[model samples]
Target chain A: MEHLLTEDLLCNQLQHSTKQLYRTGMVAQISLAISKPVSQQFACTLRVGEVGVLLAPSGAGKTSLFNAIAGINQASGFLKIGEHDTEQIELATYKRNIAYVTQTPVLFGHLSVGALLDVVSAQQARPFDIKWALEPLKLDTILHMRTLSLSGGQRQRLALLLAMIKGATLLLLDEVLTGQDPSTKLACITVIKTYLKRNQAAALIACHQLEDALALADIAFLQQQRAGIKQWQVMPISNGIHAYQQSLLNDCADTAQDQQTVCASAFLSVLHATTISHDPQLGLCEYRVAGQPCFSAYSPHISAKQSVLLVLRANRVAISKSLLPESSFVNQWQAKIVSIRPVSCQGEHGMLIDVTLVNQGALTTSQQDVVSVWITRLSYNQLHPKIGESWYLISKADAVSLSCLN
Target chain B: MSETDLQAIILTLQLASLTTVCLLLVCVPCAYFLARSRSVVKPFIETIVTLPLVLPPTVMGYYFLVLFSPNDGLGLWLRNVLGIELVFSFSGIWLVSMIYSLPFTFRPLQSAFEQLPKDLHHAAALLGFSPMKQFHLVILPAIKPALFAATTLSFAHTIGEFGAILMIGGNIPGETQVLSLALFDHVESFNSQAAEQLALLMLIFSFVVVFACQWWQTQSSQNGYVVNNHVEGL
Candidate 1:
């Protein structure tokens, strides 16, 4: 029988709210209030040598949760490492056992990379293979160089190497590969995975990019909602990419239609749709869409069939006092002046007019079609289009194209 | 050099060394306490430790004279119990030097202890090193420069002491006559050559000691053993 990969996994994981208190680490019980009222709570447990990845949108409290576990911040739960268990221990002692890698690479500016590893290993009384670690991270050439001279990605890799040298049983990495290019990120991930496997070391990493998380994670814990951190479900590696995508669709489908409309309107609403004819000069699959026609200008991830919203730069639009005759342009609409406001652009005064176009019988039908166009106050005065006056909107064919649905 | 001059220099060195050793033995725990203790009385005790640095030396000398005089109750008790008389003797000079240099020894060591990363202590504890072992292995090694600075500063400061040593023990030859006092005696007797030579020697000794300490600090920092700079994002 084929495995059932339902969209409900996404919905349940995203919508389900549960409170879990983690008392693991060196400190005592840290209660994460995971519920609708105060939901920014996340909880996950990993045995020694286990590796887990936390996938969450940016600003979803992943760093906050990591900090609490590392004993850098006060958490309302119990944490135990080794023997002495309490909310408070000598901070240095706590740090000596746990190594933290921040989103931005932080290295001692005064020390060489080699010296950093030496100091940490000496303090921990552990013999570390500095050359081996640096070689894997592609930092062997720069081991003798000053830490201050390294680039952002290089510094991040160096920080990881240092943390490993400390031999901390638990490593908490926050967006550790965020600053690296795709190739470098892939290389770093491979090194980390191999290292964890060989050493049997436990690691918890927080990442915004899904591909990186997917490539390295043994078990994925996704942050569903903003308020409560609930573990909707866990998937093993056997489920694959198809299962993940299906779970996401099911999760979206399980939400009430009204809720879906709210999310869709705010994020995925198809503001405009247009077709592009095949032109060798313009290339294949080139098209113009609605809204502001600046989607392709802003994002690089645009593709066919994916919904997009174009942010209309008001200045790029033209408004005429009379209805525009049908022409070769991509967009033309008859609209009434809803509101007019003055806006400044590059030391020049301009008027931003919000025009509402009527379609069918209802106002909501074409409300999304209503677009704002910016014209100089001088030009607006010359035309003198009153608030109640009617006019047509026009945009050049090349001014708009397909946009990525963000 | 005259017999008196040679004897005073020897006595001064002996007293300063002994006082520094004694001061370290007592000040290690005191400095550590001042650095680490969170108790409310710490400030009060620290003030008392530093009082000698600010107190008028003559006034301190007068107080010690009264306390250690043969007829005084404490003096009589010490004499009966330990067969020791502290007034007008080499021992009295040693006692006064230790008290006078307390701040010199404790302040630097205390500040150094305070500046050490608290995380190092925590790491030591997690490593199963008991508190005592942690001090010996981690805390002491980290504060080596401060300890050296404290000992040198205290020894130099005690050797140069004049007012308190003179007022309490007087300038007795081969007993209470420290170098500073003997130099004063030479000047009084119109022996400018002897007085100048002694002053020059004292200046050279202090300069060499201080310069050596500075060089050692530079070498240690270059060795990358001392973590003076903060580790970012930790």
Candidate 2:
């Protein structure tokens, strides 16, 4: 449980003019602790054998932070990687043993895939295991092909495998999972998990996919920018989910997109559930969250007893005053309102109510689940709901989008 | 052909080959630096390298003549300390050709390096390859077309050297005398047959250099095979 990277950086915000390079008088002060041994008061710690998702909008300095850690950009302040004080010692990028896979895969265009594999394998003290690493990425077939001929997804996969082969103890993956197919993305997440556990390494993955972040992040950091200043806030996965959803709302609103899409993602609530049964014939899957049974439409690829991450749009969930209803809604769970906040999306006023599921004796305090329900201003006024009051959270089975993580 | 004509052809080939090889050795690294450097003086250095391209060959030759004169300090030091003569010798003219053809060998290389993807060197470094290995395995392979063009152009320019060679090293057979000088001599003395032979040979050589560079570039683009700019081998 040792810290892998610690950074306190102060960098100039530079802008290019037609005639000169000038500082914009806005300096970025960033402090980060990657895989810290213990959670410090200020910085969020991603310990050993953990993947921390970095959630931020565009132009929020996510790539800049990655560049600083990889020594591609200059940043001056306290910095450490493992036992070395990188700032004091001045280690080169290669010597830091950190692999960075950019958004666009930066493969060696001149070398064939096989040659690149050979060269990467030779550079390691422990030779790269081709079968173990390449099989998951589906790169075994393209060994003889030139890297330039590879599709974007294939290039990303190759870049991931090559970084793994290099035995880097820390990985900086910037938007690498964007636009990937579900199966490939699942495989990539799985490979990263196994690699981290096996080597006791760590990764800081920057991604915009909230679902992927929910499935992959052991801890998450949210970056918020205001008036050209950026700040980082660390939280557990659940809070990170809420923060990310809110950020999505702001982003969509900023772009003046349709309010429905913005509001739909803004109030999304993530539930960590385990499948109890999957009826492939009926295309229905039953999962248990907070010791209560919930059903969702099932995919044939998902089996029983596997862990799944479920996303439910807040507006899709409803609040009921009575016990389990006999309505068409297939899900109704006992819960207590924890908090309520008023939200307005493009002049459509609503109330966002947060509720914690009343778990049976089978679960612990941390395992207690929180779900958000959206209701119109009329419904909020009619119900006059109070905090810690009992209610039923109801939703139809088809409203849940489920992705199996394991 | 006369024995002196044969010697002139041999001397021209030797000088071209030596100048091309040595310039490549020196200029590749220089080009890489210029392409990657952000220093304020980079433009100044680049301007200096490109100066020879715009200046007449005779002008460069005149400067070298003054610099390498026997009475000059550097020339005197070379003779008294290193025992190397710069004026009226094969070595003197070879040096002059290297300087004269500097841009031919360097400009293409610099352009190639600049056009390369910016992440290539950084990616190689993160993969634990040393700088030399990165240059050899990544930079060299990626810029094969420019390397080819630079080599052919430098060789051809040296083969056609007339003014610089004449100024620095006079027509001395088996020493400084090359094909162009020998052909110039033949024309001056009205040796029509020998002059015609030399002119035809030079024309054919020039055509081949141009044709080879064009063919290599076309093959590289058509085949999508990058290393050595050909698809024939790995």
Candidate 3:
């Protein structure tokens, strides 16, 4: 009896292995391109077990790119999944191995959750415990409930679980967590990541939010729309700042000379306003005037006016309880403390104080009305200002830069 | 009951049962293919299947008579190979009924199959079920209501068949003469009382059968299985 059981198990494992090999060989290899009238092109090759995160402005063909890969749209390029080298396979058969979760959850609605799973499992000839599957997705409570009764997030999770239950090697997810809360989104990411890791399944997710993509992406693909669809460029999160700055510089290059020159002058003026020491070891450069800390930057070349906006370093700015004496070294203003948040920077204790700046007497008018600045909690406490108290704020001349805006 | 009347009833039941069985075997696959296939030939096949639904009964009957005549190649082959003539035979009447009721059976099943979520089939494939297994296990079970409705419609339609069956079967007692034909025979023979009695029986039987089928369907649905409610293809 034991020998027979072992033989049966071995046979089942062999059958599974053969089916997987066939499926892997038959999976499509997709390359996508978007061409616009302006001749902007983006393209990328998709591989199994690789997570491709697509980020672009709305209408950037993110959805279209996925559709083309799924063979739901007409696209000009090579789309081969494994050995199947056809523009479109038999639609029904081709779609059988690919699971696509649309932006909106589309369910049969009539079948009970258990019944639906049973039918799906029976058809797939795979052993599945519907109750066990539902439990992880938090859908066990609603197994007997009507599909329409599920909330948006619940429905989204259900759709995801359904796709997972299908056991497809490739999953195409489109804005699956568009309206989910932070906790729900985190939970969903955890579920998806675990599924991908366990099954070696490749997923292509279209996302508009950076945080979500960063949370789950193993490989990040940045998509930009030009004349048409362009190839996705894999970028490292560690180089996020540099990449962002370079892209801004490229954008600035397209502006008229007058505008660029003006932006450059503004940046220069801010940089030259003051000078302060920055710690090179900490990647912290500070600009201050008359011993009053103002603005800081990660790089040594802290200039006020670059044709781009520089990131404001959190450490250099100091806060005080009362309005300090008027000084030439730093920009000063009265701001009401909104919130006090604790933070850690490079093994140093810090606090982030959200302050609403009161621009009382500045005369320069601009298209945008107000500007807000973030200060550390230590600075806010040093100022000894209460939550609603308005306190004086200031920045060194060099730290106050208009140079990078160009 | 008279011998003729009793024979007609038995013949009617047999023809309807046979037609329903044949229709299911042929139509299940045909309907599933029609529902799922995206081939270029789909529209052409659909038009052919639907021709009987719109073609006048008399026109269809004329074609059947011509097609089944012994002089025709197909008819001669059937006669020689099967030792049976289709014209003016009970088998001829069953064939006509199957053709006439094809739309009634196929449309419900087709729509039912179509209404099933394509994702379910995709899931099945990923789970490693072959095409045949998926159809039998997933597609068949999901479209059970449509199957039931199709069976009921086809059975009822076969039982009430007249023009096409008449053209092909003639009014032979104990062979081709169904209940409907039996009622017509009574009227033609000037047996008014017998004709009235048969008519009343036909009316009551038709009403009861249809109502009972419909009630069963409604009960199944109310108990939570949703029947296919989409418009049937003519």
**Model 3 misplaced stretches (Cα beyond 4 Å):** A1-51, A67-100, A122-133, A146-151, A166-171, A197-202, A224-229, A237-406, B35-48, B54-56, B71-73, B111-130, B190-197, B208-234
Q: What clash pairs does model 2 have?
A: A35-A46
Q: Which candidate number maximizes lDDT? A: 2
Docking class of 3: incorrect
Rate residue A135 of model 3 by lDDT: 62
CA error at residue A308 for candidate 2, angstroms: 5.1
Q: Score the docking of each candidate (DockQ).
A: 0.15, 0.47, 0.19
Task: Let me know the DockQ for model 1.
Answer: 0.15
Top model number, TM-score? 2
Candidate 3 contains a number of clashing pairs equal to: 45
What is residue A322's positional error in candidate 1, in angstroms? 34
**Clashes per prediction?**
26, 1, 45
DockQ score of the complex predicted as candidate 2? 0.47
Residue-level lDDT of model 3, residues B98-202, one tens digit each, is 899998888888877777776656445444456787678656766667778788778877888877888888888988899888888888989888788878877
lDDT value for model 1: 0.62
Worst 10 residues of 2 chain A by lDDT: A13-22
Can you write out model 3's per-residue Cα lDDT over A1-406, one digit (the tens) per residue? Answer: 0111222343344334544544654344444333432222333334445566765545557766665555555545443343344344335443445566767765545566666556555554343333444665677777777564568888788777776766665677888878888767766776776666565556778875544554555445554433333445555431332233234334445543312211111111111223445566754555432223444445555444232222222333345555557654345645567655453322334445545455333343221111223454545456555677776655553454322212
How would you order the candidates by DockQ, starting with the best? 2, 3, 1
How good is model 1 by TM-score?
0.58
Query: Candidate 1 on B1-234: residue-level lDDT in tens?
Result: 888899988999999999999999999988887788999999899898889978999999999999998886898888889999999988888899999999888887777778776665544443334577668866787677677777888888888999999988998999999999999999999999999999998999889777866776676566433432111100
